[model samples]
Target: MAQTSASPDVATRALPATWTTNLHLSSDTGLLQEGLDALEGYRKKDPNKVVVRFRAIGNAPIMRQNFYKITVSNRFQAVIQFLRKELGWKAGEPLYTYINMAFSPAPDDTVSNLFKSFATDGHLIVNYSTTAAWG
Candidate 1:
């Protein structure tokens, strides 16, 4: 088969009249931007802080205070660090952390996103064990 380019006139005629008129944004931005403002309003804003509840899995030691308020911007690594600090575990010590007793989140995951996705009763339940607790 031979290849042929579409003529500019054919292409221009193919589009609806509204397409040509709306191609350049109007001075009244609202004309082209209607309903977009509502989309912005509907977006869920992330909280500044997220509540994290720590639970011991299996033989892991229990914390005197199990609840903590962590900044939303912090990563899951910060949670591990906080756990080590609270439990008096050294940096090199083995500490396994899980979310909601189900899965382990990556250390780089933002706390806010985790909280938003997996929080229960406004708390991010984090289960910790010195040894590998769950598969």
Candidate 2:
């Protein structure tokens, strides 16, 4: 089962610092598919456990983007490189994110709604804009 945060807000322990970059995966479905594929592949190779999610923020470019931050690990640099090179989630012009989850649940935490948050712990919150326009 997943672990919960100290706060009643229902969160998991933070992950080790992972990656930091950007992507063009818009807020749409088709493009999100590519982003998902890229990310999932990275997760498989990543030593530290991590997860990614997409929240529909209407149809604005700013809204369609995601915020990815190095939630918990120390190897932040390596992960960032992976995101830029291995994965095609490139950084964009004046990227910005508004993430706040110092307390996320474990991967199996009930408080996290079965990881519906796509954030088991502190995550690589990338405020990305995929070509799909809603990824």
Question: Judged by TM-score, which candidate is best?
Answer: 1
Q: Candidate 1: where are CA atoms >4 Å away?
A: 1-47
Model 2: per-residue Cα lDDT at residue 53: 33
The pairs that clash in candidate 1 are none
User: Residue 51 of candidate 2: its Cα lDDT?
Assistant: 48
Q: What C-alpha lDDT do the candidate models reach, one value each?
A: 0.86, 0.37
Per-residue alpha-carbon lDDT of model 2 for 4-90, expressed as tens digits? 534543355443444312233345687669989988975643234444332322342442334443323324343334344433445
lDDT of 1 at 11: 59
Listing every candidate in turn, what is its Cα RMSD in Å to the true structure after a full C-alpha superposition? 8.0, 21.3
Cα lDDT, model 1, residue 71: 88
In Å, residue 124's CA in model 1 sits off its true spot by 0.3
Give the TM-score of each candidate.
Answer: 0.65, 0.22
